[model samples]
Target chain A: MTHSDQISDSDQMPRSAWLCEYLARLEDEQVMAQHGDARILAPAHRLELDPEGWATAAKVAAAMGLRHAGLWADCLDDSALAAEDRAIRMQACLEHAGDYLVLETQVPMLRPVLASQASIYPGVDRLERHAHDLTGLELTSQPDGRRWTRHQAWPEDRFPLRGDFPLAGEPVGRAPADADYPFGRVQGTGVYEIPVGPVHAGIIEPGHFRFHAMGEDVLQLEERLGYVHKGIEKLAVGRDPAGLARLAGRVSGDSTVAHAWAACQAMERATDCIVPARAQALRGLMAERERVANHLGDIGAVCNDVGFAFAHLQCGRLRERWQRRSQALFGHRLMMDAVIPGGVAVDLCDKVVEELREDHAQLKSEIVPIFDVVADHPSLDDRLMTTGVLSEADARQLGCTGYVGKASGLAFDVRRDSPYAPYDGLAMDGAILAEGDVAARVRVRMAEIGNALRWMDRLLKSLPDGPICAQLPEAEAGAMGLGIIEGWRGEILSFIRFGPDGRIARYFPRDPSWFTWPALERLIHGNIVPDFPVCNKSVNGSYSGQDL
Target chain B: MFRILKKSFQTGVVTETPPDVADAEFERIGIELRRRIDVRFSRSLAIRQVDAGSCNACELEIQALNNAYHDVARFGVHFVASPRHADALLVTGPVSRHMEAALRRTWRATPSPKFVIAAGDCACTGGEFGASYASCGAVEKVIPVDAKIPGCPPSPLELLQGLLHVLRG
Candidate 1:
């Protein structure tokens, strides 16, 4: 598990210069030097490792302080390989400072397995399980082997991600009950367990929360999710760029604008095409609007959880009104399917832009006072202030981002640090807080909403006049691209590979919930059961996003 | 608090009348379902929602049904916590494989007069995420659906009208 000794003195360069030189030195036969190929991608460098080198490459990245971003598998063509060597391609994506490094290897299907990175990156526990369940590629030492994405839909041997596997799976009389899922237990004098939902009281996504508590205080809270998994990754294969973008938008309904934008950015990059400046601005405008809308809703929902109905009602009214504008200006309340592969589907005119500015100004006047009332309220402060504290170390270890990370002191923003297209020159200061509590999270969201509104104004005032979309040439077979965006929730990273006739070979859209959901489990320890709802509302990890 | 009190009076009944609920053409179905329900149950309806596998777009609209603008509670329609307490199950999504049994169990939990209303296009027809290895498309495929509302995520009023339609039978 430890590879630091193998790093040698040659690896002691500055962090930025280390990777390139280190990668070059890797060509020497002494260091993880299996028959592998390395290529520098626009956003990240990709290293296609031999099975022998895959684990070491991942360890190297993790040791260098690179956070695990995502992990997925791509199926290999069995026709080219001998029957015994027919394998599935495993991919591991790690993020450093701001750049990403995608490590890959091939594991034969007969006994397809790779060393688990969960030992190094505890966050990969679920992601590795997902790859195992879908692709039938097992990990050598994955600690928690309980089903992650596979919920007994397919039999043990039937892998859905395989090219030969059927989409309409053969189901015997009925799917067995998922009730017997083994939850971790606590055995003590005062410990008892409370199991809540796959069916919840409120109209929310289905997820089971098992709490091992001593009287009122929680000792542990383990979340059993994947109740909303619809096989989105398996469904994405073979879809063309436009079709893939549509699928991406539905990855999480609330994040339609951000997911589709990321997918389109990936496709545009793979095809080596640049959209017009106006198109980029339009994307920025839509993204900021989506951010403000979600934050308003979350702030309100947080208050509602604590019995502050007035703020909840006010925020709900504002969010509803805001989405109504999205419907008017973009033709859909959620702005679903508005982001196409080449560019956006709609254009903004002068009068519409002017009206939007006026509405934006009016919205500010209304929300600031509402925020003051909620912030100053003695009861709400008592409920939210110091509860559900996820320390800076926990947030960093789990790679939390968006409001969750910013609230907990992870100062990473894709818009500013890794600025794409429209955000190239935007200033993003004063949006980070380091308290790592429910109140800090709420504060971070409010501050983000404020910043987003200002960004929208700047974008609209200097709106460029040009074509909104461009003609994208068909992607070359074997072309690959990466798209990373700072979505409302946090950073959304998408990886795409093109096959014949512009079809997708593999697509993985990593939602920020991947990090924050774990942070939820960590933060809720030692808190009372009644405060669980508020803590959960604070993180607000999209079940659909995580389940996918 | 004074600001809220003043604004509350100034807003002046944002909640709509039962029959005049503005939405995506749910008025026709509302009238039809009202006729089908027994007078006893028509006075009040309780909904227990089971999200089989929805992306939660439908859940948001359903939540909005109870919001200030579209308060279904005023019309004697409210959401309950338990299926036994519920008269009908407002199901969403193209039933994910894991949730299929939970949906069936939820149905079994409800009493004999229990009904099912499939909301959202995914719930009605599976929408884009059709029958697959992970999903058994549509709510009716698992449990019988009495009423179906269709949209990517149906509007709040559409849900209101659909619930009325279900109550009729």
Candidate 2:
């Protein structure tokens, strides 16, 4: 179908119905469809597909303009199935609008192989490699089969996510340098490479960037991350719901609130726990605060990159004040551990609510004028405008989300598109622009900060008076839950499965950085090498979030 | 331009005075740190931060030290881009296996008479993600550490105090 044809159909029908009709047209008999649990706020349609159907579904989904949301694999340790059927279950999440469909296929433990989806959705490249690295799965017809989460840490034969493989793998005395990892070569006279950090000059997370450049202009930029991989999945294998929430909060410390909420949402849904209305509102409030704080810091950092020290300091000061308020009200600066399995850990009394209101007003007054100055600054505009532009077509293909995608005209906000409790009937605005440059990204952040402040005001006014938490009931073994949250950076998808003894069987929190990180590589094609920092800051993919 | 200047003028010098050394142990360390700074390396202390394998929370707090509130530069402590120019290395996270070599290289690159201060519980004692096949628990496991600032992530004030304590020795 043509783009126009599909758009018309998509506009006429609801997203779920349109998607269901499209999937039906694929005519794959092996595709088994089932409706997800009604308890889930954004319920996903589960699809059990054969190996052939798995590869075809991804290709068909791409053709139908479905965004590749997430891809993860879980090792099944059940001995009840025959040896031929004893397998690893691989799941691919495809999303369009607010609707979600999970495509699952089981690959046998002996010679686990599947067709690669990277050719269709470029964002799935690293995730497929990650699944392969951790679960010993092989991808046939793959493009760029380089090892991604395995950098001389584990031998070729060993896979950390296997049930038999111990959490604490055989510790080596010293790890060797990953110098031999092949980087794609751009052949030309004076086409040199600038290799930047696993340890950057600035105080940030570790990830290496290889820039193929000639003179000042960059030819290509490739990112080699996963330096912060701490066996998050392996460590999460047997954690209780509370323990899992703590682990999730740390997935990306900056995004602590969002990650924790997503994990908790997943677990809460799996166990059919009904979170109290007050707790839901508080969670929304905390998430908005988190978004504002990060945006303030980022807007300033982007300015700092272009040598705008005044904006940087002002933004930083405001962000520090914002986080200090969070610490006072929510108990943690990042609001980590505030969102538990069923509900929130802290509640706002009248006095605390008043304090929050006063702080919000103070922040709004201070930041508005600063943003005005930033938006109108001539020198800032000269550097940021039309620099490192990510085309909308490229963005759609890469499945970019949050400000990065919205700035580029691919407006897909999880909060607005898939409204959960607290946001269902809330008055909110999404900031979208088609400029797709550093300035656009910064503008998106500024707009988001304003919206969050307004939302917080509304939530504080309508603050419900009730219990802050609900007890999570026990879920039967093999029960799965999915949580999709709109974090500051972008969409955060968390998948959770409960074990027989009420412990976590499998947990995978896919950060939006998994998709946006590739967009950075695409956007930085012809930009000058020095502009890389500003461009990178604009996209600012979470190293720890994706690395986990 | 006028608005920017006017705003700057209105927000003049928002930096606050450092918190008074109330605790006896901290006061002792503060005095010792002052003496060391005067005698060994002038007043300025340059630190190179290495994210060994942190959740990035510690890094955020570390960055906060430079803001207008803390303004750690005024305290004669500032972050440097290179380890060679650093008097100490401020490291965070439970050293992941992939970063082991990089961390060691960084430590070796620092000049003699340099200290390594482990920031956050992960760096101090591996926090929640303890030693696994992928991680080498704690910063000290890979390289010698002089002092440890412990919290899931120590606050900016605690980090400043931790830096002062390490400077004392």
Candidate 3:
């Protein structure tokens, strides 16, 4: 049957309903549909699919306009399954509107291979390769099968995520260089390559960017990341709920609040624990503050790239003050480790609430004028406008989200699209633009800062009265949960499964960078090499977040 | 131009004084650090930062040193683009195995008499993501560290103090 024949009535039904109906039509006897844990904020549906159903599901989801959210896998202990059964379970998360559908398929240990979904969702290419490198899962019919996240740290035969692999695997005195990894070559005399990083010139995370350019115009920009992969998933094994929360916070330092919240949310959901209303509101408050701080820093960095030191300096000052307030209120500069499982670690009192209101108002007054200056400046506009354009079609195909996607006209904000606690019943405007350029991304960030400030004000005014944290119950072995949060960058999808003795079996925190990083490669097609820094600053995909 | 000038004038001098040393030992170390910088390095230091495998939180705090609040450059300290031009290497993270070669290459590229300051708990003690199949543990394991700053991510003020301590040596 043709792809359209399967989803002919998709338009007539709600997207989630149509998606569920489509999956149900797959007609595999092994396939089972069940309601996910109640604490998972989104309307979640889990399905067990055969290998054939797995490949077909991606095609159907793509045809139905469902965005490919994430792809991850975990190795199941051999003893846990029958001798003939598969030893690895792979999950593909697909989203429509705010609804999440998780598709699961098992792979045998000896020949662990599955059909690749990269053809349907181009962003899954890296994730599939990463899974292969870490879990020894191969993909048939894969596009670009280069090893990702493996840089001569371990041998080809070793799969670190496997149950038999020790957490502190055979250590070597020195790791060999990864000089043989093949980079896509651009032929012709005029096309030359600019190799940058793994150690950048600035105070930034490490990732190699190979730019094939003809003089100033960039033909292709390929990034080789995973330089910051510190075995986060391997380290997460056997960690208790609290310890896992701390590990999750470091998934991306800048995104500590969001990543921790996602991990904690997943754990809480898996254990069916309800976070108190007050704690939920506090988490929301910290998340919004994180959004504000990151946007401010990004806007400044973008300006600095184009010689607009005025905006850079001013934004830097404001960001410092903002972070100081966060430290005073939450006890950490970046507010890291503040969002624990079952609720928040810190609580707000009337005094701090009033102080925050004053700080918010002051920040608004101070930042608005600077933004006005940046918005009206001709030099800044000339540099940023029409540079690094990512078309709307490319954005949708890559499943870009957050400011990067919103600027390119893919308007999907998890907070607004799939309303969760604290954001539910709250009216918030999504800042979207169609220019798909550096200027548009900056404008979206400015708009988001304003929206977050307003949201924080409302949250403080209607502060819920309850305990900050709740007691978490032990989760049954093999229980699974998912958390999808709208971080400052974009949508962050976290997956967790409980092991024996209530420890974490598998944990995967998929950052929005997974999608946006590919979007960056597409966005820089014809931009000059000099503009790459500004374009990069505008997108600002978290290297550490993606590396992990 | 007029608006920009007016704004800059209104937001004049947000820079603060050098952070105060709490204990007598640190105060003594601070004085010695100042004297050594004046004597050995001619009162100017260029630091090259290497993020071996950090979560990028340490990088943020390091960048904050140059902001208006800290203005570390005013104290004769600045970040350089190359190791050859640097007098010290400020490293962060647990030194992942993937980054092992790169970190060693960076250290060897720096000239002699260059100090290496391990910034953040990860660089000092490997933090949460300690020695693993994928990580090489503390920075000192791969390179000799002159000083260490311990925080999940050391604050900008703590980073300054760490830099000073290393420079004193």
Candidate 4:
């Protein structure tokens, strides 16, 4: 069949109907779809399937108006898919010689060519672009042909995601030296270009935002990232599985638990290994704590950026105390290396739990007053209230997640939708609002802090006792795994493929920053250049995270 | 004010140290210059942090050193905005090809007496990213590294020690 002919016939249905039926089918199959009101899930069996069968299933999912939720193909035995077809359709290749694919195609991509899915599933715009970027697979009828992730690092002809790409260092050509990148400009009469930083005033990560403006109000903002791109994807290829988890932890310093959990989940899914229930709970606790810590810091930083130094000072104090408590309990301020492959590295002792409970109590009692001070003051709100508004529609279109999404009224949290581990056992009230402005973002942070405090209290009150980690079965060649964790930021998706003797064949971590960074550019419209710092702080897409 | 006072009370009374004892003492045999030298310190350092596509472990260590225990201000190496005013460039991770230009820009931004301290295995050489295609593999590739601090994620103390070396440089 021609490539266009491969497009399934069922792509014309309305998304609402398709989503409902998919969820119903998942429920019928005893697989539950969590927090996303629109998301659905279906499980696959352990046996190997044909490439055509896999493609057909993806086509059906696409036709049903469901994007691929990411595939987790676990190759446990030698009897996986046949070699020729496996080279193309496998979501990630395995070290154990096992096969798995986790594809997240938009509702629009399921149909045959002529009518592309990008128009319908706007959320998949960057996603499909990135997928094509990494895997070098041709996404038929993709909206734009521009290079998404490719720079001068690798051979232009060679695709890095291919199994044949060298893991060893290669001397590459210089990056695109032209000062002007493909950033769209405003069409108004008085629009001017205001280029700001791959470097900035504060100690934030490097991201250059090109603003097209008419007078004081921003007409448009386009972000050019990848300044700190380390080729983390290439580094992960052929690494030990455990090593990948450690690497995942640092994908974003503040997002350790989420990224680690996502990577670990991918590994577990591929191995078909179920972590102990308690480990799952502890992981959730860690994720929540991370979320709280970052939110606290950001709230303070936002205030500081706006010249409200008292709130900044107080928040800084609280944040410092929180980090100290974390250090006292987990041995690192940021809880680095506290999460491991099979489970967590740090487990809560009774003392640690008690200490955490004490900290939570203090935070809960004090935060309200601090936020009150923040709210009562006009200057703080004046700078924050409607500055950098990311409209609700734009949030959905850009697939903004975490506090940014919730602030903009997109109520998608992996914890609630996916319902993995401790999040399912405990309630996650992801505070959401629809204003889509800086103030709403701050409010979301405040609300999330309150919720996180509650989560900490609950976790401490009923701290689980168990072995923190488990010895994994020696991964044979071609073993594959998928990890999905709702990091403090949002969904952290890690796809791992193990080579023979348990080496990572390929590791891809989709940090939430990937989706959220673009949102920063979109949200800055109508705001003056001076307020960019506060707006950027409110969104706080990680430069390191996105670079990785 | 009352709430602050109450919080102080809740924290319990911290015994005041005597002037002579509180300060680190230095004595001459005959003339006891009892003029105690209080270690006057500043909590700010004009720090220039360099990134070499690090796993960010060393960066985390640097952040940890700034946090509670080994607070950089105790020795004074704060993360500053511009390198022109920075006392040191705390370089982290293996230098990647993409960051090479930025690293050079940052290095040139610094004024005289500026020290470049490579803060991790990756910063010292191409840590893991060294073998990979994306790596330029060390701070020396872009700038002369004054000190190399080793460890996957060097302990907060090690980072502090590296800073000390830079301060002394």
lDDT of each: 0.81, 0.86, 0.86, 0.62
DockQ of each: 0.68, 0.82, 0.83, 0.31
Residue B100, model 3: Cα distance from true site in angstroms: 0.4
Interface RMSD of each: 1.3, 0.7, 0.7, 3.5
Please say which candidate is ahead in DockQ: 2 or 3. 3
Q: What is the lDDT of residue B141 in candidate 3?
A: 93
Q: In model 2, state the lDDT of residue A499.
A: 84
1 or 2, which is superior by DockQ? Answer: 2
Candidate 3, residues A273-298, lDDT tens digits: the string is 77888988898899999999999999
lDDT of 4 at A44: 17
State the DockQ, from 0 to 1, for candidate 3.
0.83
Q: Identify the superior model by TM-score, candidate 1 or candidate 3.
A: 3
Candidate 1 lDDT, B44-67, residue by residue in tens: 678899888888788877887777
Instruction: State in Å the error of residue A204, model 4.
Output: 1.9
Q: Write the per-residue lDDT of candidate 2 for residues A133-213, one digit (tens) a residue.
A: 999889987798999999877787899998778888865568787888999889899999999999999999999999999
**Decreasing DockQ order of the candidates:** 3, 2, 1, 4
Q: Candidate 4, residues B52-151: lDDT per residue as tens digits?
A: 5665446545654443223344444467777787867877767666666677777888887677888877788766566456666677876898888887
Q: lDDT for model 3, please.
A: 0.86
